[model samples]
Target chain A: MSVKIEASEGGRPHNEILGFGLIGSLVCIYLTYLNVLTGTEIFSFFGGLGAVIALAWGSDTIKHLCSYGLGTGVPSAGMIAFGSGVIAMLFATKFGIAAPVAALVIAALLGAVIGYVSDKVVSMNIPVMVISLIELAIVGALTMMGLAAMAGGSFMFADLVAGSTTVFGIEIASYGSSVIGGSVLAVIFILGSIAVQHPFNACLGPGEQQDRTLMLAAECGFLSMIGVAVISFAFIGFGSAVVALLVSIIGWAYTYMEYIKLSRRDAYDWLDAKPIHEPKGGA
Target chain B: MENLVLGIGITALAGALATVAGAAEDTESDIGSQGDPNSQVQLAPQMGYIHRIYNKAVSGEPPAYGLWCALGAGIAWALMSIQINAVLAIVLGSAIAVFVQGVYATTAYLGRTASLAKFEQPVYIDIIKSVTTVTMAHAFVAIFTTVAMCQLMIVALGHPFPLPLLALVWGIALGAAGSATGNPFYGKERQYQEQKFGAGVPISASGNIVRYAEAGQRSSLDNGWFASKLGGPASGICFGLIVFLELWRTVLFEQIGAGWGAIIAGVVLILVFMVIDRYIETWARKTYGPYVAETEEAAS
Candidate 1:
């Protein structure tokens, strides 16, 4: 019994890491295809994908199960999946629908088929890669076909055969882009994780570190507002500047306050302080 | 009603004066330590000017300041009801005001945090969530302030009132409610810290001087004081100033439209806040001595 328990525990990390990598790779491919073919901006598509990856990496299903036992993984998994779906939608909206839809269909079908085959096949990395590629292909294909159907064109297999050249071109570009973007992002993540783990790191010592991360992210978001301001001012006139500045200031203040409140609450928890008064119900 | 406005104006004036005095005292004391006592007095006015700017920039409760500023602008529009339709005037005013405050606050946060290194944890998720939440809240504040002021006007005239009075009422209500609601969030700590330190302990010598300096540094790079002050009075000041600018713009240029005015206000608010925050911090450091000195003095 002890030997069996030890084996099971030892096997889990390998399985989990493999699962993470597979899921991440598949998601990245699907998003990339959508961006390249659909005309989505690289930033929007990748931003959402990055968020989904972060959620998946941070979530520990086994830990949840051990702590709460049964039914615990659903909420966390649901949130990650929902966030991914939103990212996909946003990507589709920005890039145009053709590539995303095709990628979606191709990726899904491929993932399902490979996942099934992997049950019989004894290989590890190859199976994961096969599943990911299948899903990417299915997603791309289905997306394209669906759009074609909407345009009142034929949805024949022959049409897909003819369209495959354009589809393949999109696929290559997307794949190349994803690999570069994801690799760079992954390196950043790895470095950050290492710094956090190190004992003597001065920048982000362990106490309530999550709040700091959130703040940094919020700060990045302010860039979009500036972009909006510049665009509005250029198009509309100096009057636009007034509206832009007001909106930016108020929004910033509110978010800044919220960040402070969240950090304070976390710090208080770390210090074992009594609960502070919550906001009154009305406002 | 007149008394309240008078009271607010007086308080704002007093706060401004106190900030100036505090800076002067600090400059005088700081001169000896710098081995240049003569240069200190000349520097005092410059330092005092900076202190006022900082006070203005980094003062106020976040949501409340924005809310009040919008309300003030709304009231200003309602005051013009005789010339324009009441509803249109109120809408135009509140929209301009709220938009201005929002933009201002956003720029301030961006400018301050742009220099910091990225964090290890996942920042994007939390930031997106918080910003979305805050933006929605700000929008609501704008809507609510407009509605509340309109209601006050309806009751005051015993008939459908003119637009100008409605605008005035809206501005007054927003300012008053904001002050009342925001005071608890912004000044609560000041009150508590003051009480804890007692009247005898020089206000300047309070232990919070060290805490504030450290918080300033941390917040310069990271959002260290989120939970405690909820960005405190500094955020509030940004909100208020944005609203003030929105009102000023509307009064100055009627044809520019509310939307554009708001956007401009937002950007300026951020720029102004940063400038003031920089000086305020310098004053704090100069006045209080080095952070290490304060810590050592406290320990001994």
Candidate 2:
């Protein structure tokens, strides 16, 4: 008897796509409420959401998501919503209500510019970090100046300046702490990850095939860490330092555990399979 | 002492396993089959609970335990000696403790033979997956818990804790959280699926690149499964740690001279580690010989 399996050409079901949209919308609404309640404008949230959606809808961006199990339909939708939500909240807190929209615009433009420049640059990581750091510095300076101008010699301005400065001061201090904390934590994470991978590679040997796939997975793992850092910095300002350290550790741990679990499962499956006996017992 | 003994024991066990496995698989015909044989060691299908326990136990590896314990003790002393709130001291101390632990682990293992290279393909993948998960968990805990803890400390102590202390505490918390609750089941499902298909089965790829670029989807699908599972968590943890550390230090510690001191200390330590790692790698290469030389030596 012969069996046949049919392949489908269509994309993910409409319902799944719609489900992501619905989730995105709900998150948007909640974010909007939070911003308004905090006395921040709503435009920041909307603008952030718009930017995220645009990225999700773009072919290049969607391709990247698809590389990871995130389907274009639902996963993209969730990414749009989640990314926007987080970015919006971060901007609102850091730059105030009107700043999120501006930040989104700036970030998009910056991302494009950086993308172009990165193609020309030999070392992408350092340049990217530098660009991000510069952008952050500019935004911070501008925000402080703008707030000072708006508060123009009134008691309210005094309070605003005090509050803004206080926030900024707090942010600065936190960043310092994060650097201290993150340096150590990052080192540990790197060591742990290396340790795990080293023994694994040794056991697997050098000519086991699938080198390209493993390399890609490792690259993706590293990229994922960078992505987390980018998103966090774009949203939370200085607070992202601490977040970055935590995120790096988490990423490393998750990758390590998952790899172990999957390998073990494969081993079990192999054990259960019927062994074909060769006359010479050689492949 | 117990922790040190435990660390030594685990290291010995792992080292023994590696030597035995290596020796067994060293036969001439086993060259390309290393990947295949390594993939054949899965003893359990759904050992999620067992995996979790194993992860937890291993997380407190010697380096981590020693660093954290030392930092914790220091914080306790600082709290008692100064007019600092015990809570603030403890939290900050813990954060620093874990951060130190992480640094030690990274320094100790990088470019060293004490790594996962002895296991197999899936084991390597698991290490990455677990690290990502742990990093994310740590990030979340640091962000949420530190905020709450700092606020409480401020209230109880009638002022915010010192910036150095805060940084230390936050770092430890994030590290601990990452080590404890990060993903432990990253690549299991994909490995099972591949096993079910019985190695060498062609797999289809789906994504925007496939539709627009006319690229062969199969090529990209190799890392797809594992990468997909890991992307979010990895990104989350990375971003969280960077953002949190940057913000916390800038806001709370920059005014104080201690923050700069800490930064300098960190840089110096990293430099030292880098040198050590380089030396270790050089030693390994010189002692083991090149892959070709080793192979020839074994044959003779």
Candidate 3:
């Protein structure tokens, strides 16, 4: 719900969107903790395209603070930056303080104390808004621990207590799939929360551009790399799930052919295919 | 405020369902044969959690009251702790709560007569008829009535609300049941819309409305202004592959005879997923053609 275009046209510069979100979250937390410490899943589809280039720099700072109007502040600050970046990246990678720290700096310091108590306690001003809610909860806890370590390869904590903890009634199966990290990690935590909040809430308006909202935020990060290559092919195989479904159908045919060349410079497609010139006294 | 933070999070979920209803019958007979009909199942995300609470309740939100009152007190403590058959979990949980409360009461009575993101284009053909009636009402319902109401309240409401109070009662009951079925299509009396596309409502000769004057901008291949129509990303990936093959046909879901080959491979995968989603929406309108094809041939 943008009002102030100010000057829009496929905009970008802001230090190339925070240098591609702090160098794409330290290169997808070093190719997802180097395939969860050398065990490997073939550079896990570039760690879900480096957490979709760190949620296209926290959805281009939610298209520059919902283009200043802030109608439903870009999905209530991306649902409180993915609910405090998936509860501080699952309690700093399952309690044991992420094996001597660095669950993306404890989900970017718990998304800078829930974006400073929602911009100083529930006001939700937004602006730099605690570093775009700690870069959309440290790229949504590094794209949910790089798509739950590329479909349960290993994000550790004994492979999330053998693929998705159960405890008392016990499940902890390890690689031999107990619904591989339980119900495909609850369907990639609800399809990575709708591929990190439907690419800037369906590319906002004045036909909000920014290279067609970072090429529809890399076509919602290649539809979360076809939902982490079809739910991490229930423990990555079939040639790394046919190379993460041919790198998400060739990254959704090169970002939908540059989003049909930026929806042909829309004024809702030239005020409905250029005709109405209603001027003199027609007002 | 958000209904006083959803009435103190549904009265601390009715005091954690009266303190986990006295440790439900030996954890419902230790996950009672993972919802019986013995083993090897595939899918049952109860029509993918009612097509993700009617596509996040008409995209904006509201509904998901403390995760459907902790999935109605975790389906009465996961059918008395998974001993299952509370009349087959209330006849598949009242047929998945009367098929997601009759697809959220027919998209809250066609969003008070056609209003998905405030109507437009042949009233966005009735807002793509509530996203093709929530992607063909989850492939004509029966996503195995949510695999024993999600393995009887997420494996017997897992010793009382783990997974961050079950992701904050499934994201505050999917935003309080999509804001009580989108509060009777709030602020009604629209009379054909497109209010300057995404509101900021300006243009006027008494603001359009000779049946909402002329219009344009529709058909989006990539989440343009909320899924640029033309089978919005092939019916949101055919309602997420009919709730990921109805919970991947209940995991270890074996079966040879009697099962008519998993009902003829789920009727040939819903007739090749409606012929590859109407051949990828007529090859994405004959290869990336419409961002408003010459404003629909200069509006007829």
Best by DockQ: 2
What are the DockQ scores of the candidates, in order? Answer: 0.02, 0.05, 0.03
After superposition, the stretches of candidate 1 with alpha carbons farther than 4 Å from their true spots are: A1-54, A58-283, B1-238, B254-300
Cα misplacement distance, residue B38 of candidate 2 (Å): 13
Worst 10 residues of 3 chain B by lDDT: B33-42
- The TM-score, computed over Cα atoms with residue i paired to residue i, of candidate 1 is 0.24
Question: Considering every candidate listed, which one attains the maximal lDDT?
Answer: 3
Provide the lDDT at A100 for model 2. 35
Q: DockQ for candidate 3, please give it.
A: 0.03
- Candidate 1 displacement at residue B149 in angstroms: 12
Proportion of native contacts in model 3?
A: 0.00
* Candidate 3 segments exceeding 4 Å error: A1-15, A18-24, A27-53, A56-58, A61-142, A146-180, A184-186, A189-199, A207-283, B1-260, B265-300
Whole-model lDDT, model 1: 0.31
> Which candidate, 1 or 2, would have the higher DockQ against the true structure?
2
B162-253 per-residue lDDT for model 2 (tens digits) = 43244345434433333222222222333234333322222221110111112422211232233334532443344344334433334444
Look at candidate 3 and tell me the lDDT of residue A110: 82
